[model samples]
Target: MAHTTKLNTDLTGKTALVTGGTKGIGKAIADELAAAGARVIISARNAPSAESTHHFIAADLTNAQQASSLARQINDEFGGIDMLINNVGGLTTPGGGYSALTDKHWEDELQLNLIAAIRLDREFIPVMTARRNAVIIHISSIAARQALWNLNLAYAVSKSALNSYSKALATELASKGVRVLTVSPGATKTPPMEKFIADYAAAQNIPEESALAQLLQQTGGIPMGRMAEPEEVASLVHYLVSPAASYLTGSIYAIDGGALPVVS
Candidate 1:
C-alpha cells in the first residue's frame, strides 16, 4: 500500500538568517525558505546589484567584530531567528596541493568556513535555546570526505573541521530545544561552480564540457551522471530544518547523488 505523508514545512511564524544569501546555494535557500513562508534575512559583505524581497544586511562575517554586530542587529530587529543557516563559506585559496597554500591561505580558509560559523552559533545558540523548536543548519561540502588534494586542499580541510564541530554542537544541544545539523552537497550547479569549470577549461585549453568531465572523473564520477541543482539542495535543507524533521539531529546529511563510494 502506498501511503501519502504530508510534510509540515510551514514556516509562517518563523524567522531565518541565511548568510551569503545574495548568490548561489545560499540565495536558493533564502528563496525556498521565503516561499515556504519564513521571514528570511540574508547577510553578505556587500549588497546585491539588484533588489530582492528578502532583507539584506551588509556584513563581513569573517571579521569577529562584524559578526558580533550582525548578530546583535538581528537579535534587536527580528527578536532572534528561529532558523540559522550557516552558508557563508567558500574555496578562496590557490590550488596545487599543500605547497601552493601558505599560512595565510590556511588561516583564511578556516576563518571563512569554520570560525565564522562558530562565532555565529555562539551568538545565536543562547537565543535559540531559550525558544522552543529552533534549527541550525551548517552548509558543508562532500569535499570534507573526498578531497581533490591539488585543488581543494585548504577548503576541504576547513569543511572537515566544520563537520566535526557541527556534530559536537548538535550533541550538546540535543537535549535543548535547538536542533543542529550539517548538510553536505556534492558538485552542485551553482554560480561559483560554473565559474570554476570555466576557469579550469580556460587554463587547460579545453572545452568547458571536457573540463567538467575531467573534474567529475577526479571525484570518481557521480552515479547520477549529473550535478545537483541548487534548488534540489535547498529542498533537502528545507526538509531537514522543518517541523517534520524534529527527530533528525547530530548527523551529516549528504546530498551527493551517491558520489561517496563508501557508506559514511
Candidate 2:
C-alpha cells in the first residue's frame, strides 16, 4: 500500500510579489502561492491572461524607471509585501565562447539576472525587514554551477553571481529577521525550454527527440531521465517561502533531477 504525505506550506495572510510571473515557471510559482492563500502580485513586461486572478503589473525590470514605478504602485496598492520572488531572467544572449559575447551581452545578462534582483531587493528590504518574518527568493539556474559555455556563457556567469549575492545577503539579513534563499532549477519543462528544443531540432535538421537528447547530454543529463515540470519547481518555492521553512535560510535549494555531477 502507498501512503500519502501532506505538506504544511500555508501562507494565508502573506502578500507576495513575483517578478516575471506572467508565464512559464514564474506563472507556476505565482499560482502555487495564491493557492496557498497568499495575496499574490505578479509583474512582467506583458500582461497576464484575462482569466488570471492574481493582481498584475506590467514593467520591464531591466529599466530603472519601470522598476521604480512598479515598486511605487505595489507599495501604494498593497502597502508592502511579505515575500519577493525574483524570477525575471533568461538566456537572452547569443551562445558562443568568450569571444562571441560583447560588453553589451555581458551587461544585459548581469542586469537581468543579477542586478535586477539586487535593485528590487533594495527597494523592498526596508518593508520586509520591518515585517521581521519575510522571505526573499532568487530563482537562479543550475547553469550557475554547471555552465555550458557554448550555449549560455553570459547567462551562466550572471546566475553564478546571483548565487553569490544571495548568500551574502542572507548572511547580512539573518540577524535582521529576514530570510534570503536561492532556488536553482535544472532544465525545467516550460514554454521557453520547449521552444529551445524545437529551435535546436530545426537548426540541426533532426527530430525534436534527438535534439532534446543531445541538449540533455551536454548538461551531463538529468539522472531522473526527464526535465522537471514548472509545477514541481513551484512546489519547492512554495515550501521555502512558507512558515514551515522558518529556520531555512541562506541555502541554495536545488530542484534539479540530480543533474549536477558533484556535490555543491
Candidate 3:
C-alpha cells in the first residue's frame, strides 16, 4: 500500500462529523479526514454502512428538528464536534427549472442544501468555538456559481444560497475561534454522477456516454479532460481540516478541473 502522506495537521484527538457521509464525496471526505488521524463520524437519514472504520449516525437533515437534535447528539456522544462536513443536498426534481419547480420543491432544496448546513453551524459550531479550535467545511459545488444546468437550476440556486450562507457564517464565527470554509468540486465520478448521467441519457434520448460527453462539453471541456475521482476531492477536505489551513476561512476552493472561467 502507498504510504499516507503525513499531513501537516495531525488531528490526533479531534472528532470529525460528516453529514451525508455514507457515500460519494461525503464518504470520501470522511475517509480523508480519518486517515489524517481524526476519529470520523458519518451522519445521514439512514445509518451509513461501515465501508471503512468510522462511526455512523442516522438523522435526516430535511427536518429542522432532526438537524438540531443531531447536533446535540454529536455534542453528547462525540464530546463536541471538532470538524463538520455539511454534504447532504441535491435537486428535488430531475426536470426542474424556473417554471417547473414548485414552492415545495424550493423548500426541499433549501432545507436540504442551505438550511441543513446552517442549522449545524448554528447549533454546533458555537460549542467548537467555545473549545477554541474547530473546522467546518461545507461541501459546495461548481453549480453554485456557473448556473449551467438548466434542468438543475433549483440545485444551482440552492447551492448559490449555501455559498452565501457559508461565507456569512464564517464571518460570524471568525472571531469566535471556528473556521468555516468551502470545497467545491465539479462533475466528480461518484455514484451520483452515474445516476445523473443515466438520467440525462434517458431524458435526452442519448447514450450514457453521450450524456457524460454533454456534461464535459457544458463545463467547456474539463481542461483535464476527465471528471475528478472522489479521492481527489477528499484530499482537499483533508487539508482544509488539517492545521495546514488554519489561516483559511470564508473561501470557496474549487477543484473543478479549471472549468470555472474567471477568478473571483
Candidate 4:
C-alpha cells in the first residue's frame, strides 16, 4: 500500500475570484485553487484563447463601472468569495526612463496596476470582512524594487505604489478578519513575456537567447539561472491564501529566484 501525505492547503467549500484570470499567472492561480477544492471564478477583458473549466466573467477591471459590475454579479450569484486575486497588471508603457513617459502613460499604468485593484478591493471588502477569514493577493512585479528605467519605468512605479497600498490595507483590515498581501514575481515564462522578448530581439537585431540574457543581466540575473514558471508562482499564491498562511499578511513576497539584489 502507498502512503499519502495531506497538505493543509485544502480549500474545500471556499470560493475564489481571480482578475485577469484567463491567462498567465492569473490562470495558473485559478487552476491551482480549483484543484485544491475551491470554486473558482475568473474575470478578464476578453475571452480566453482556450477553453477553461472555471466560471468566466468578462470585465475590464481598469474600468470602474465594469469592476463594480463584476463585483455585483459575483455577490448576486456566488454570494461572495473567500479569496480575491488582483492579477491584472502588466508593463504596458514604453521603455526609455522618465523622459519617455507622458502623463497619460503614468496614469494608464497606475490605473491598471494600482487603481483597478483598489477599486475591486473596496467593492469586496464588506463581503469579505463578514466572512471568517478572507484573503486578497496583489500580483506585483519585481520591477517595483529593481526597476530598469529603459524597460519598465511607469510599470515599476505603479507596482511600488501598489506595494505600499497593500501593506496599509493589510494593517487596516487585520482586525476585521481580512488579510491583504503582495506577491512580486520576477521574470516568468508567459505568453506576454515571450512576445516581449521576441519583439526586443527583433528590435535589437539579436537572437532570442541573447535578448533574454540581456534582459536578465539588466535585472542582475536570476541566481537560479532561469525564469520562473507560472505554476511556481501559483504554488506560492496557493500557500499564501490557504489555511496554512492564516497568520501571514501585510508583506511583499518575492518569487524572483534571487534576482532582487536587496534583502527585503
lDDT of 2 by residue, 43-90 (tens): 999998657999999999999988989998998889899999999999
How far off is residue 247 in model 2, in Å? 0.6
Q: Any idea what lDDT model 4 has?
A: 0.94
Worst 10 residues of 4 by lDDT: 1-10
Candidate 4 per-residue lDDT, tens place, 1-264, comes to 532323579999999999999999999999999999999999999989998999999999889999999999999999999999999988888887899999999999999999999999999999999985999999999889987889998998999999999999999999999999999999999988999999899999999999999999888899999999999999999999998888889999999899988877
lDDT of 4 at 139: 97
Q: What is the lDDT of residue 128 in candidate 4?
A: 98
Reference-based TM-score, model 3: 0.93
Q: Evaluate model 3: give its lDDT.
A: 0.84
- The alpha-carbon lDDT assigned to residue 117 of candidate 3 equals 87
Clash counts for all predictions? 0, 0, 0, 0
Flag the better candidate by TM-score, 1 or 3: 1
Residue 14's lDDT in candidate 4: 98
lDDT of 2 at 107: 99
lDDT of 1 at 211: 97
Cα lDDT tens digits for candidate 1, 1-264: 642334788888999999999988999999999999999999999897678999999999999999999999999999999999999999899789999999999999999999999999999999999987999999999999988898999999999999999999999999999999999999999888999999889989999999999999999999999999999999988998888888889889999999999877
- Model 2 residue runs over 4 Å out of place are 1-7
After superposing candidate 3 on the true structure, give the runs of residues whose Cα lies further than 4 Å from its correct spot.
1-7, 49-51
- Residue 201 of model 2 has an lDDT of 92
